[model samples]
Target: MFGYRGLTISDDGILEISGVRCDYLVEKYGTPLYVFNEEEILNRIKEIKENHIVKYGGVAAYASKAFLTKYMCRLIKREGLWLDVVSGGELYTAKSVDFPMENIIFHGNNKTYEELEMAVDFGVGRVVIDNFDEIDILEDILLKKKRSIDVQIRITPGIDGHTHDFIKTGQVDSKFGFPMHDESALHAVKRILNSPALKLKGIHAHIGSQLHQNNIYKLEVEVLAKFISSIKNLFDYEIEEINCGGGFGIYYTEGDKRLSISYFTDVIHKAVEECFSRYNLRKPTVFIEPGRWIVGEAGITLYRVGSIKDIRGIRKYVSVDGGMTDNIRTALYSAKYTAVPANKLNNKDEEQVTICGKCCESGDILIKDIKLPKLERGDIIAVLSTGAYNFSMASNYNRIPRPAVVMVNRGQDVLIVKRETYEDIIKNDL
Candidate 1:
């Protein structure tokens, strides 16, 4: 119910998404399916671009790691937002669609030489440098090619985010970027500035993922603004921009307090404005990357209930056809989600059941002890807020094929990603 814009309960008590009943989709496309609300995604993109980026005269890059397909890249391109790719495969996916290379920003903690060469060859808009070795490797490649590429220095601002430890990357002890409190950041700036093949355009920092506090982004702006001011005062050079890497949180359940896009943009904009004035320096353009926020709530996963195990005085386990293979967020990050009995929306009989996957592992539980309508065999279960990391992180673990992805709007369902076949799973094995 978090992203219930186009969702409605029919008079017969059937849950419908974008006017398409859940059972109808399951019958047509089969369960263990991924469905995205096309209208919701388009609206989120428009809101970010018009209400936030355009008003501030900055760039909005869609972090492809949240979700990426050739069609997804095309959609981001159609919206006129930049693409933020973290790996060679993502870059190739974008290139396959002929996504504007100049609107692409390449980022990674350990980028290979081939990836850097590919970025330079494709004339990528900017490369976010995370370490000193990357600087050396990039300079070597660019010098050999006699080409100059724009770059952004990713500095660790030492801000601890209130997210899972595995996703935190902005602290000083992290292995992501140059630490600002130490001399490493300054040395990196000097090294990049001296590289004849690199143009140091700006600085970049990302605290963590699924951040709910607006003050964190404000602090990021203040810290980055101070860094820019120091560079200007020390080297007498102006930083054109600062990419505050995206980690905006989204609501997956009723307990989540979602932050608006304007809350982020307005706070950071004011922080940048005030900080620049305080430091007596010119304001630089801002770049915000939002991946999950834009697409998280726009997607839902539909699965079919299979086996049920009842333990007296214990917990009732309801198994679904799909498990960690299709949605690994729960197993990987301990992420929480909400689900409903799509086929029995009006059923008054409710039970608290531990929804689990068909995986062989005991830790493959998707939702732990959730109240849902009494489930039965063949019941279609719709898991909400799965639009972000679910499909992108899907795997062929246990030889299970991934599910198909469909986009629905105004009652029309279009298949975007075809379900993986058993043959497709072994196609890569030699």
Candidate 2:
């Protein structure tokens, strides 16, 4: 009902996703299942390709931090989009799939020496240098290996994004990149220019996540363009690429203002053209790394209602088998979401109820004060727009094994990840 493709209500009032009944999925995959619509994901990617990549000759990299799997790696590769990995584990996953290491852009704030070695050894396409210490570590590794790698310096654009404070990365006081008003960035550039192993290709900056305004990105471009011009004047070197990291917002609840892919891309492309032209600099190759936009709306979490508690004149609590461990955004970022009764889609009896998880923490509520069909024990509840961070950020808190992940498309379903077992939880215990 929130406008995800392939979602419909059956004649019998059952909620169907991609031509498959939600109850059938619960029967097969069990409670607390992570279901993704494969066609919806591809459509999002296709939209990026058409609006940003093809229209402006830019690169679209899938930010793997939002969600990553061996299957996801293969899917990204097959779609002709680049992969953005921030840790050695992500790199290993990509390597396991042979996901074209040259198409990979390695990113991390504090990349360990071993991870840098792995990136260098595996011949990753680009390493986004976050700090001066990382530059030194990577230079040392490259010197020891006698190999050169293309690199980009991540700069703090000093622009605060219109998002939560926890997710803001491009602010001046952030720990992510070199600050614009300081000499550290310039010093790092000088060091990289002298180092034979590190090739400084360009600059990158990601303001924040869940960004809604397009003008904010335009301002980021203007700031980076001015910096690039100053760099050319000082070092006489031209930057070949400008990586404008992605935070395009998606529809989660009715209150969220969702913009089209073109809404942001059009502004970004125009800003790059105008600003770079004004600075008299050559137009550089642009790269955008989108994680949530491509996957958020395509995913839904199915939880079977377990318990119902009603307090007279106060509130009603509908507990599910899953909670913060399965989806932590509600507790972490105070994120909002929408849901529906999969089995009672057409039910007329509705009541205001609070949806909560099975975790022991009282703050582990998923949705608060939402109106839904009068719920009962064993009812199937499907929460929408959980496709991005739910599976990737899931944990085994309270020894609760994580749920399986299923991808549905064109009336077909396949389990992409297996549900964790009790033994799997403590398999590393001595």
The candidate that achieves the highest TM-score relative to the unseen native structure:
2
Return the top candidate by lDDT. 2
lDDT value for candidate 2? 0.93
Q: Can you write out model 2's per-residue Cα lDDT over 1-430, one digit (the tens) per residue? A: 6666668899988888878899999999898999998898898999999998898999999999998989899999999999999999999999999999999999989999999999999999999999888988999999998999999999999999989898888889998989988788888888898999999998999999999988999999999899999889999999999999999999998888767899999998899999999999999999999999989988899999999999989999999999999999999999999999999888988999999999989999999999998999999999999999999999999999999999999789999999999999999999
Q: List the residue pairs that clash in candidate 2.
A: none
lDDT of each: 0.91, 0.93
TM-score for each model: 0.98, 0.99
Kindly list the per-residue Cα lDDT of model 1 for residues 272-339, writing each as its tens digit. Answer: 89988898888888999999989998889999999999998999999999989899988889999999
In angstroms, the error of model 1 at 18 is 1.7
When summed lDDT is taken over every stretch of 10 residues in candidate 2, the lowest stretch is 1-10
